[model samples]
Target: PLAAREASRVGAHRDAAGHYEVALRYSDALPMEGQAALHEGHAFECHLIGRIDAAMEAQGEARRLWQALGDRLKEGDSLRCLSRFAYLVGDRAAADRFGVQAVELLETAPDSAELAMAYSNLSQLAMLAERLDETLSLGAKAVGLAERLNRPDILCHALNNVGAAGQWLDFAKGRRDLARSLGIALAGNFQEHAARAFTNCACVEMNRLNLNEAEAFLDRGIAYCVENDLATWRDYMRGVQAQLLLRRGLWNEAATIAHDVVDDEATTALVRYPSLVALARLRIRRGDPSAGPVLDEMKRFLDKGMELQRLAPYAAVMAELAWLGQGDRAEALRLIDLAESRSPTRAVVGELATWRQFLSPDSDPGEIDGMAEPHRLLLAGDWRGAAAFWARIDAPFERALALLQGDEAAQREALDIFEGLGARPVAQHVRGLMRQSGVSHIARGPRQATRTNLAGLTQRQMEVLQLIERGFSNKKIAAHLTISPKTVDHHVSAVLEKLEAVSRGEATAAARASGLL
Candidate 1:
C-alpha cells in the first residue's frame, strides 16, 4: 500500500495501479482505515490513467469506508476524486455535485492543502463550462491557499487552472503564468503538472501561429508522457500534434494522425471530437466525397451541446465543409452563426466572419482587412480582386482558391506554393484543375518568398521582424498580431538567432539587408 501510494505521488501511475491492485486483493486483512486509504490511492492511480469506471468504483468504495469510519476529510477527498472522474467522463452535472460537496466538507477543515485542492477541482469544472471569470476567481483562491500551505501539488494544479483562465482573458499574462507553472513543476519534479503545463503552453503557442514553438513544447510533452506511461496525456498530445500538422498544411500527415486518434476505441470523446473534425476538414480540402460521413459524426457531437470553447472551432470547420463541400449555403450560414456565438476571442471571430462572408455576400462582415479581406472579395464575386489581395498578403491558399475561378498562370503559381509547403491534398486538387485546363509551360510571375527564406526565417518571423522595424514593442506587436507577447518573444528570439544578431536593432538591420523587412 505504501509502495502504491509513493508510486502515485511520483507519477508512476501504471506501476502504482499494478501495486494497488495487488494490495487490494489483500485489503480485507488490513484495518478499516488502511483499507480506505488503499482504495483511495488505487482510485487516484486509476484516474491518472483514464480508467474512469475503475476510478469511480474504487473512489466510491473509499468514500463508503471513510464515511463508515466517520472520517469527513477522507470522504471529502474521495468526493473530489470522484468529481474529477465525472468531469473527465463528460458528466458535468455529477461532477458539479461532487465538487460542491467536497468544497463544502473541506471549507471548515483545517487542512489547507485539501481545501485548496477542492477549490482547484471547482475551478477546473468552471473552466470546462466556459465560466472563465469564475474559474479565475476560484483558481486564485486555490493558489492563495496552496501558497500559504506550501503544498506543491495543490499549487501546481491551481497555477495551471489560473493560467488557463488568463489565456482566455489576457494572453500575455497567461503565457507568463503558464511558463512559471511549468518551471515550478519541473523544479519540484512534479511530472504530471509539468506535462499538463507543457500541453497548455503549446496550445497557446499553436493558437498564436507559432508552429515551431508549439512543436517544441509538444515534443517535450509527448516525451514526458511516454516516459511516465501517461496514456491519456500521450494521446492528447498526439491530437495536438495533429492540429499543428494541419496548420502547417501537411494534409496527409495530419489526416493520418487525426484518423488514429478518432479510430482508437480507448480515446475519450473530448479528444476524438477535435480529431474527427480535423480529419473531416482535411478530407473536404482534398476533394473527397466521403467527407460527409465524418462531418455528420462531428455534427452529432455538436448537437449534444459540447462545451462552447470546443464548439467554436468545430462550428467554424463545419461551416467551411458545408460551404465548400456540401454546397449547403443555409447550413453554412447556421454553422457560422454558431461559431460566432460560441467564439470568445477576436481571432476566432475574425476567422468565422471570413467564412460567413463567403457563404453570404450580402451579410456585412465589418471592416475588410488582414487575411479575411481576400475571402470577402472572393465572396463578392470579384475573383481578380481576391487574387490580387491574396497575392499582396502572400496567402497562397487563398490565392489558389481565387485563381480556381480564373487566371491559369496565377493558378500554376499557387500550385507551386502548395507543393513547396507539402500541402499534398491541396496540391493534388490544384494539379487536377491544371490538368483539366491543359495548361503547360506557364510563365513564372513575381512571388513573395516561400515560408522559409534564404535567411531561414519563417513567414511569421518575417512579419514579426517587419513589425519590429516599424518600432513595435513585443506587447504592441502581440496586440497587433492578435498573439501573445510570449509568442512575440519567441519570434523575436528566432529572428535574432537566424540573423546572428545580438539585439533587436541589429536583427532589424539584418532583416532589411536580407530584403525581408
Candidate 2:
C-alpha cells in the first residue's frame, strides 16, 4: 500500500497501477475500506495512463464497495472521479449525471475537502456546458470550502475552473485567479496542478493577443510535462504551441506540429480538435486546394456534438471556411450566427462580424458597432483603413486580409509582408491576384533593407518589444516570460537602442510607423 501510494504521489502511474493490482489480489483478506481504497488507487493510476476502460471498471467497483460500506464521503469522491472520466470521454450527459450525484452525496458530508472537490467537479462541468454564471457560483463555493479546509489541491482545481470560465466573462479577474493558482501550485510542488495553471494562463495571454507570453508559458508547460513523463499534457501543450506558431505566421512549422498532434493516436478529441482547426486554418490561408477536405472533417466533428466551450471556436473557423473557401454567403452567415449563439463574447462576436463583412462587403456597418477596431473598419467597407489599423497593431495576417480587398498598391504591400514573414501560401495567393490584375513584372527578388531595420533585434528582444508595446512593466514581463527582472531590463534596453527611441512608447510608435512592428 505504501509503495503504491508513493508511486502515485511521484507520478509513476504505470508502476502505481501494478502495485495496486498486486494489492488487490489479496483484497478478500483486507478490510472493506482498505479494499475499496486499493481499487480507487488502481482506478486513478489507470485513468492517468489513458486506460479508460480499466479505470472505469475499477472505479465502478470502488463506488459499489463504498456504498456497501455506507461511506457517503468515499462514494462522493468516486462519483467525482467518474464525472471527470465521463467528461474526458466526451459524454456530457454521463458527466452531468455523475457530478450531480456527487454533489448531492457531499452536501450533507462533514468532510470539507470532499465537499469542496465535489463542488469543483460540478463547476468544471458547468464551464464545459457554457453555463458561465453557474460555473462561477459553484467555483466560489468550492474555493471557500477548500480555503476553510486548508486543501490546496481542491483550491487549485476550483481556481482553474473559475479562471478559465472568467476569461470570456471577466478578463481581469480571470488573470488574477489563474496567476494566483499558478503561484500556489508552484510553491506547493504540485506538478499536475502547476501544468494546468500554466495552460490556463497561456490561454488568457492568447486572448489578450500577447502571443509571446503565451508561447513562453506553453514552452515551460511542455518542459515540465516532459520532465515529469506526462504524456497527455505534453501533447496538449504541443497543440497549443502549434496554435501560437500559426498565429505568428510561421505556417510551415505550425502545420508540421499540428499534423503531429492530429496524428497522435493517444490524443483525446478535446486535444485533437484545436490542432485540426489550426491546420485547416493554415491550409486555407495558404490557399491550398486540400483545405476543403479539412473543413469537411471539421464539420463531421461538429456533427458528433462538441462541448459547448469549444463550439464558438469551431463555429468561428467554419464561418471563415464557408466564406473564403466555399464562397457561400448563406452558410457563412449561419455559422456566424451559431458562434454568436454559443458565446457572444467579444472575441467570438468580433470574429463573426469580420466573417460577415468578408461575405457581404456592402452590409450595414452599424450592425457591428461594438466590434474590435480592425473588424469594425473592415465591416464598414474601409479596407485600406482596416489594413492600416492591423499593420499598426503588428497583426500581419489581418493586415494582409484587409489589403487583399484593396487596390493593386495595397496588394503589393501585403505581398511584401507575407513574403517577409515566409508565408508561402498567402504570397502565392497574392501573386495569383497580381497575375489576374494584369500586373506582370512582379519583383520576386530578396527584400530590400528598410530605413528602420529591426534585423538587429534578436528573437528574445522582439518578444520583449511586443510586451513593452502592450504596456507590460519590466516585472510583469519578466514574470510572463519566466525570466529574471534583470534580464528583462537588459532586453528592454537593447530594444530601445535598436529602435533608436528615447522611451518605450516612442519605440513602439516608431516600430509601427516603420512597419517593423
Candidate 3:
C-alpha cells in the first residue's frame, strides 16, 4: 500500500493502481487493523485518480476496518474524506451530517493538526452550502484551531478561510482581514501559499476600487508564481492580470491576453468564463453585438456547477446577463449573493460583489471611489465620460473594454496605447489578427435581411416592433404606445412580416444590426 501510494505520488498511475490491487489482495489475509490501513491507502489513491465513486467505496470499507481496529481517529479522517466526496457529488445534506460526526469524534483527539482538517472541511462545507453566516462562524473556529496547531500548512488553509470570512464584510473590514492573512502566509514560508494570499489581497483591493494597490499586489503575486514554477498559480495570475488590464483601459492588450488565456490548457472552467466574458465585453465595446452569442455561451457555463468554480466568474456572467436584457435582472444579483456566501475569504468574488453593488440601481456607485467609476458611468453609453475617467486608472482591463467599445477606426490607435503600456502579449495578439479570412471587422448578422427591409411598415407598426425588440411585454408596449394589448399584437405581426424575423429577439438583433437602436 505504501509503495502504491508513493508510486501514485510520483505520477505512475498504472503502476500505482496495480500495486493498490496487490495490497488489497494481500490485506485479505491480514488483521483488521492492517486491512484498514491498506484500504485507507487504496481509497486515498482512488481520490487522487479522480475516481470519486470508487474512492467512496474504498473509504466506506476503510471506515469499517478502522472501526474494527478501534482506530477512532483514522475512522474520523476517513469519514471526513468520504463526506467531502459526497458533497462533491451533490449530497450536501449527507455531507453535512457526516461532517458533524467527523468533528465530534475528533473532539478529544490530541493532535491539533489532525483536528484542523476536520475544522477546515466543516468550514468549506458551510461555504459550499451557501450558508454565509455559518461560513464566517466556522471559518473563525477553523482559523483558531489552525493557529493553536501552529503548523504552516494548516495555517495556510485557515488563512484561506479567514480571507473568505473577511470577503463578506464591507471593504475596510475585508481589506484588514486579507492583509493579516497575507502576513501570516508570508511568515509561513510557502511561496505558492504566499502567492495565493497576495492574489486574495489584490481581490480585496480591486473590490474597494483601489486599482493601484490591486495592481501592485497582483504583479507581486504573478512574479512569485513565475519564480515558483506553479502551473496553477501562473494560470490564475494571468486571469487576474487580464482583468486588471481591462480595468486600466489597455484594450487591445487585455483582449489579446484574454483571448490567449481562454485557450490555455491549464485554465479551469472558472477561469475560462471570465476570460471569455471579458473578451465578449470587449467585442461589445468594439461595437460588435456578436458578443450577444458569446454572452449567451457564458450564461450557459454559469448554470453548470458550484464549489470553487462558482464564485468570481459566475458573478461576471450574471452581470453580463442583466446588462444584455436577459430576464430576471435579479438572477445576476442572486448569483452574486450566492458566490459571496459560498466562497472562502477570496478576493475576486468579494471585489466583484462590491463593484456590482456599486453599479446597482439601489446604491451610489461612487461609494467605490475609484477611477473605474468613469467606466461604470460609461456603461450607460457615455464614451466621453469614461474616456476622461480613463486617465485615473492604469489597469489593462479598462483599456481592453475601451478598445472593445471604441469606434472601429480607433482600434488601430488603441493598439499603440496597449504597446505604450508594456502589454506586448496583447498587442501581439491583436496585430496577429489584422486580417482573417471570412471575418467581418464589423459584424452584420441576419439584419432583417436587407432583402426584407421594413419599408412598408407604418409609424405605429415601427413603435410596436421597437418595443417588441426591447423585450417589452405586449401589455406593457400597449401602455407605452397608448394602444390596446390586442392592437399591439397586430402591429407585432405586421412588423415581423416586413422584417421577416421569427421572434422579437431576432427582430431586435436585426434592428440593432441595422443601426436602428
Clash statistics: count for each candidate: 0, 0, 24
Runs of candidate 2 with Cα error greater than 4 angstroms are 25-28, 286-297, 304-308, 364-373, 380-395, 415-517
The weakest ten consecutive residues by lDDT in model 3 span: 437-446
How does residue 175 of candidate 2 score in lDDT?
86
- lDDT for 322 in candidate 2 is 59
TM-score quality measure for candidate 3: 0.53
* C-alpha lDDT score of every prediction, in listed order: 0.73, 0.75, 0.61
lDDT of 1 by residue, 240-292 (tens): 88767766555446666676666667666555666776666666664544567
lDDT of model 1 at position 340: 60
Check candidate 2 and list the clashing pairs: none
> Tens digits of per-residue lDDT for model 2 on 175-226?
8889888888888877667877888788778766677789889999888777
Best candidate, TM-score: 2
- For candidate 1, the TM-score is 0.72
Comparing 2 and 3 by lDDT, which wins?
A: 2
For model 1, the superposed segments whose C-alpha errors exceed 4 Å read 9-11, 108-111, 288-293, 325-327, 366-517
